[model samples]
Target: MQTANNCNFRSSALGPAPLPYHPHHPGLPLALPAPVAAAPALPVPVPVAPVAPLAALPTPPPPPPPPATIVQTLTRHVPVPVLVPKPFPVPVEKLVHVDRPVPVEVPVPRPYPVAYPVEKFIKVDRPYPVHVAVPVPRPYPVPVAIRAHYEPLHHHHHRHHYLHHHHDW
Candidate 1:
């Protein structure tokens, strides 16, 4: 804590060098702070009455808005179709057939199939019913050859319905 002015300035050309105990000098071991005297008590200001808080008028209905704005409200979810006029327009003598669309559901016949495939045309050999003429051998074969000319040959031969030549075997 001793000041440079208190030391003998004979050898050092440098101006007033800080002592190691000086608080602002660098590279010196830190020393505990000197104990300070207790602070004096300060006087607190008195709380004002808050100037009576101005009276707060009723807010004047927001000053009637800068300009008028239209506010529309939606009421109906769906508009129903009206069929006949409110209370029968015609007299009792006149007959009227009328009904509201909302109350009644008119039945309409759906379309019948004009042209539709009953089954798929696959690449299959579909079966078909047909009468088949099969070649069946007779129980006992009997030659049904009718002879045109029943001429008795040199000996005898089978009765055929065709002309026979002598060279025919």
Candidate 2:
């Protein structure tokens, strides 16, 4: 029987066991082999050459100058003027006086009347009678009973007999 951890199927002499079908990729192989380690890389070879001493060369002579040729020459002149501003005079102000009217004392009357109406009141007498019936509670009866002849108490005797019988057991 196959367990959860070891779910890989084994092949028999009859034929190879059918691979489990996947819902997505139906063409995938069932059993894959363990991965192999990569091969070791070989070292690359580098070439070394011998160094030689350098020799200094002689400097070349300066080049000869070409023949000279002359072109036309031009000259121009312009004039600019300098200006100076003159000073302005300061203005002077004069004051004038005018007379206004004087106020007089006058009395004014009130807008509404000063007097109001007097309030009147009436008095009532004779009272009405009201009667309420209050409930009075009655006293409860007291229990009283007289026995002609009292029977002998048996509960204490029964308890004593039970205790003695249990001690003998």
Question: Best candidate per TM-score, number?
Answer: 1
Instruction: Please give the distance, in angstroms, between residue 60's alpha carbon in candidate 1 and its true position after superposition.
Output: 6.9
Pairs in clash, predicted candidate 2: none
Per-residue lDDT, model 1, residue 83, is: 30
Best by lDDT: 1
Residues 16-47 of candidate 1: C-alpha lDDT, one tens digit per residue: 64444534554554675689978988989998
Predicted candidate 2 versus true structure: per-residue lDDT over 14-72, tens digit per residue: 47767775435566665566699789788788787955545445557788766323211
Worst 10 residues of 1 by lDDT: 122-131
Candidate 1: C-alpha RMSD after superposition: 40.6
The clash numbers for all candidates, in the given order, read 0, 0
TM-score of each: 0.17, 0.12
